[model samples]
Target: MSTINTLGPHTPRIALIGECMIELQQRADGSLQQSFGGDTLNAAVYLARELGEGGAVDYVTALGDDSFSDAMCQGWADENIGLGMVQRLPGRLPGLYCIQTDAAGERRFLYWRNEAAVRDCFTTPAAAPILAALPDYDILYFSGITLAVLGAQGREKLLATLIEARQRDARIVFDNNYRPRLWASVEDARVAYRSVLPYVDLALLTVDDEQALFGFADCAAVFAAYEQVGTPEVVLKRGAEACLIRCGGESFEVPAQQVERVVDTTAAGDSFSAAYLASRLKGGSPAEAAEAGHRLASRVIQVPGALIPK
Candidate 1:
């Protein structure tokens, strides 16, 4: 929208905050395929791939000192994602989830994460320094799941860090990846989302999720809400339809790339958000960024997991 680089001239430093669960995808043959994925972590990996050597992408979350955790870290490292902000707590474990996909590629998830190590990501004794360091990055990326997982105290710390980060001129990017089961109630979810809206520089929203969370009637209502909050940029992603964007007081739409077939819909939005941010940080216009998002997302849905092969 600005036409100039969205993150200034330097290569941006980005930190994505959320959990990365041990993902188990149930196959048609009744076996489970294992991997690691979560909203922000999927975005982090895709962002790292999209940015390549042009920028830095780091993942900030607490993990357990276990074999699965070690494997998750190694996988991220292979994707060129930085783990400097990751903490390993003893005797704890990462969350686990099973993905079941329908014939049309839509996915449903069953989670077991009540005791995940990342639940204390921002409240542990070792978290003060991490919170203090968050403001130094060029951009902070997170999602609604990040808010949900980080209990009340942890969310407060994150909000404080976001405020401080904004004061220091860092951009805050948010994805409204809403899952009703993650919150105690719809009202509670609404409260948490409202608390962070005013601080966001860019918001990547899926129409269905917004509608489910805030009860917005349509895309128009969704945009109106973000406009009222004065968010600088907002992108509304509609599955198989054009993604509408509002930036700098103007709106634009970009159609999604048509895919011949979809194997799994996991991480579709995550890949899109990552590519959109990557394009913007590299000086592309909002429309161009949306096109980039659509391109990457089209490819992701053809794969069986949250991450396609590099």
Candidate 2:
């Protein structure tokens, strides 16, 4: 219910917290194309593109002092994402993941990320300043993947920051991108998700992920649960189906755009969430925003990777 309009004419400063990994995409010829991608990072890039000069998007995470990390920082900068809050740790490296796409464009992933530098992001001594500065942003965005990667201690610190950020009137946005392999158990993921739900102002939820994580019987059940949590705005994304939105005590459904050929399904949801949030930030209604989300996602699924060309 809280609108960016309340903040007057000032451009919103958005900070997205999570990890960006070194990405390897296996090609049809059996070669590999190396790039960078992650859930929140992909959202950050697309959000920046969607918002353009309408807002400021910053990425908050820790990376290594290595060349890959350096290239990642430069790439984010080229995308117009702020790097002021990024931390670089010596002798540490970022995570890596490989994407294998079938002929149908559905993706399967292989990860090597247990010891990534971002796991210690909020636990590091240098992180104190970044954590302290996080509460000042106009919007603070993160995802369930952030919860899984941060572990218990880092999540505690992040929760404390979210509490303070909410108190300072920063709108909290959450994307429920539940990854089973990232958490120790399903119960652990549920607890972490429930802990953050109360603080979220706008929730960008994937219906399939919600069902997998909470065993919700259907979309109605998913919306009912978020209603109980008092989330002001909720968008339920169902791939290839209509996206349902509940906001301001009303509901709306926007049909997903049809795509003839699907090259890769990577970043489809991330791109959708970014476009939806960008539209809302720019004063579009829920219906308009969902349309924007669908349009972007349709294009994204036709691409080969997480980020499409500007």
Candidate 3:
């Protein structure tokens, strides 16, 4: 790959759109610790940590004016994540979820998010400015869970914004972190994914998620679908295995770092995505970015939470 794009901007401003919920983690001793997390939120924090002066990472979401939401914003601010695009609805509240992990570090989630404030993130009157401002960013990042939460109208608005952003040469990045329970039906999910895939410049995908979403036979099938959409850069993340990257008619396999003991795999892919994009924005080759992604994910899995200490 050339490592430079004519329309790409230096010191990029990245807006990551999604929800951040009140996350409760069940400890092995039956105790629980509360925190804030979501697929895109995790990526946003990691991106902020990785990019520093290289770029600015902002989170775009709506939350209640409650104290929990206030604490959440404070936490994000502490991480140096920009919250200028985040909205606080007077009567709304953020979603909630509980994470339970097995001995193998595999995680399962139980969600109580149906009435979260973010579901209307793009539908409120105040969202007009946010929507209008979206195209101004240098890079836009989102995930499948973002789509599921937005519903029909929000997705339509987001789609329109993405189209406009692409016309202005803003690079769009997508992560296929699919959660089936969040979607009403598989067909609906497929349609939403198809609508956005063509507009994405870089796609971060997991082999297992692709299989669950599209019933893809193998990695080749996943790559074929992405190739059809003309996504210029694609990274296929396989837990504990080499990640495959396709770019500029070439493919690279980057091996993941080996972790001696795994504590949690909650944000493995999200952390990887953030590091990969940060590396790319810093002018690293796709192969180098993939390695960077794997390196960060290795450490994240060794920790008990989505974010580790700086």
Candidate 4:
């Protein structure tokens, strides 16, 4: 295996902040297989696995003090992810969801997360310490789902943390994983996203999500918007098609890896973002990083869940 030295002054720590939920998959025989998933958590695991001990990866989120939450923490620890920042709230529970797929392997999700513990992650007393320590990380990673769950006040706190972290020269990586059902309206999501754009150093966007959220006519508009936000690196992912990337004042299109069969598309973008960021943090060029993203995402989509077995 190839190893890349850590970047920046510190030990190169990455904090991925978001919620993880229990996932149930409805099988063909009417059975349900219990699992767990979240976009940021998925990226955290993949990033930790990709970085291997070259850098530290931490998953920052709130969970209930239940057995399921305990198992989630244990799993993250086993994967070499730091747990010191995970907040556990009393009398709360993690969210749950079910994945149903069609014969063609296209997937749809049904969520029961309105009252999930993570919604108050940044508001709880324990969140103070975590937010205070966040500025020390070398990189801060989060998704649109993270923003949505945080709501107004929590998002305000998180945005402040991002500002402070950016002032310390920490790189911010954002993935545009937009779920319309998660927000009150598209306008709300647009406002929330625009508010955080100034702090983003790298953005991993999906073409469809961008179009849906911001109403961009095409990829050019997406790139223009990111450029306006002053983000130095931008990668736009289009499922089964080529991904467009802009870095260091240049642009390139990297084709996706062809998969014979796609069992589940759960973590395709999350896995891709992980590999791409991992490669970039290791000093690979944008084109090389996009290829790495495609390779990992292709493998992930061939599997059945957000997390594939190692």
| Best of the candidates, lDDT | 2
Scanning candidate 4 in windows of ten residues, the lowest lDDT window is 1-10
Model 4's alpha-carbon lDDT is 0.91
| TM-score for candidate 3 | 0.97
lDDT over C-alpha atoms for residue 112 of model 3: 97
Which of the predicted structures, 2 or 4, would earn the higher TM-score when compared with the native?
Answer: 2
Pairs of colliding residues, candidate 2 = none
Local distance difference test, candidate 3: 0.92
Deviating ranges (above 4 Å) for candidate 4: 1-6
lDDT of 2: 0.94
Cα lDDT of candidate 1 equals 0.93
Please, what are the lDDT tens digits per residue for candidate 2 over residues 79-185? 99999999999999999999999989999999999999999999999999999999999999999999999999999999999999999999999999999999999
TM-score of each: 0.98, 0.98, 0.97, 0.97
Give one digit per residue, the lDDT tens place, for model 4 in 1-310: 0112235434579999999999998888989999899999999999999989777999999999999999999999989999999999988999999999887778899999999999999998889899999999889999999999999999999999999988887888899999999999999999999999988988999999999998999999999989888888889999999999887788889999999998999989999999998888887888888899999999998888899998
Show where candidate 2 strays beyond 4 Å: none
- Pick out the ten consecutive residues of candidate 1 with the lowest summed lDDT: 1-10
Candidate RMSDs in Å, in order, are 1.3, 0.9, 1.5, 2.8
Model 1 CA deviation exceeding 4 Å by range:
1-4
